[model samples]
Every structure is written in structure tokens, then in C-alpha cells.
Target: MSTAMSAAWPYPLLADMVLAVHFGVVLFVIGGLVLVFVGNRLATWPWVNALWFRMAHLVAIGVVAAQSWLGMVCPLTTLEAWLREQAGEASHDQSFVAYWLQRLMFFTAPEWVFAVAYTAFGLLVVLAWWRYPPRVARSRG
Candidate 1:
């Protein structure tokens, strides 16, 4: 790598940004279901019933579950790991935020345990879809 490229890349900061994005995705997958159910009951938050939002939420969880069941690591996780390595930093020992986020998302359990958990969570999201279906957009008269 050229010295200019090495100096301009900012791999460590990029890796940290990826970690933060991964954390936000995790939050959305978990919290989105809660909001869907609550919003359905309240009838005050119609945006939660938006088809686009629901589809995105479903797809996000679906990808996670599919990756887990297929025994494949997430691309985001792989990218972050690669970035950290490029920056000459340990995967889980980088900074305080990264360390805690790793601790929260990763566990020492067997692979099958994670597969089962992800499948079950995916099923719950499916159930939520049936329970509170997304609203179809109305055509203008």
C-alpha cells in the first residue's frame, strides 16, 4: 500500500463506524417488533404500520436468521473484523465501546445454540407480521 493511501484510509475509524451501525441494526431488529405491537394497540403511530418499514424490519431479521442457520458469519461482522486487522487492532479488545458491544452481541455458546435462538426469533417476527399486518397504501381517487 502506498504511504498516501495508508495515511488516508482511516481503517480504525471506519471499523468503529461499522461496529456502531451493526449495533443500531441489532437494536432495530429487536425493538421494531415491540413498537409494531404497541403501535397497533395505540392506533396513534401509523408510521409503524408502513409497509416499507415492516418489510425492512422483516428482511433484516430474516437475513440474520438465515445467516445463523446456514452457519455463515454476517458480512458486517466480517468486514469489521477485517478492518480491525488492517488497523493492527485486536478484534474484541479495541476500544471501550467496541469491547462492550462485542461482549453484548457475541457469546461463548455453541454454534447450534445461536442457530436455534435466531430461528426462534425469526419465527416470532413472522408471528408479529400475521398479528399486525402492514397497511397497504391507498390509491388516490
Candidate 2:
């Protein structure tokens, strides 16, 4: 939605926007790793190894793993739930931890499973960094 239109909309739309942004984050974390490995294999897709893109992808997953290990709720999830509540929508009946796993991937499991999965994926990202280093972008003066 346009910013002007969104501004005029009611509360529920904010919650929807938050959910969409959260899903985009999830896609980036997953797809970034896929491209890191696959893109390096092909002569194409060199942009995947742009230094800033690699760094952002790594940091993104790193934060996810850290949040899981620390048992902290993601701010996006918190904000979405609060917005939903304000809109008189049912946030969820599940516990805080459960909602974290459920909201993103649509699957439910022990939180430790997500912690381990994120940490393991993070290690893979680090390995990719080591094995296929990102190229620094050059600027034309």
C-alpha cells in the first residue's frame, strides 16, 4: 500500500505489514544462504557475493541464532502481536516461545530445535564466507 493510503488505514493493516516484513526477513535468511552456495558454483550471480550483502545476510542469521539461544522474543513478533491485540484480533493461544516458531515457519517444535537449526545454519554461512569470500564493491571516483 502507498504510504498515504496506509496512513489512512485502520490498525489491522499495521499488523499485516509487520507480518509481511517478518516473512521477507525469513526468506532473505534462507535464500541468501542458498545463493551463497549456488551462486558461487555458477559463473552467473556474482552479485550474491557483494560484501555488504554477505555481511547483512550473516548478521541477520546471527541475530536469529542469538535470540534463540538467549530465549529472547523477536521484536517483530512482539510488535505484530501487540498490534493484533490492539486491533481486537486474537494474537495467539500458544505460549510466547511457541508463537515465535509457529509464526514464521508454520511448524511447531521445541524451541531448542530452532536454536540448533539456526546455529547450524549460521555455521554454514561462516563456512561460505571462508570458502567463497565476498568481493568488495569498488566505487568510481
Q: Quick one: best lDDT, which candidate?
A: 1
RMSD of each: 2.9, 6.3
Tens-digit lDDT track for model 1 on 7-89? 74688888888999999999999999889989989989988888999999999999998898898999999999998888777
lDDT tens digits by residue: candidate 2, 7-71: 54565676777777888899999999999899999959999999999999999999999999999
Candidate 2 regions off by >4 Å? 1-9, 92-104
- What's the TM for model 1? 0.88
Residue 104 lDDT (model 2): 58
> For each candidate, what is the lDDT?
0.87, 0.83
Q: What's the true lDDT of residue 106 in model 2? A: 57
TM-scores of the candidates in the order shown: 0.88, 0.82
Clashing pairs in 2: none
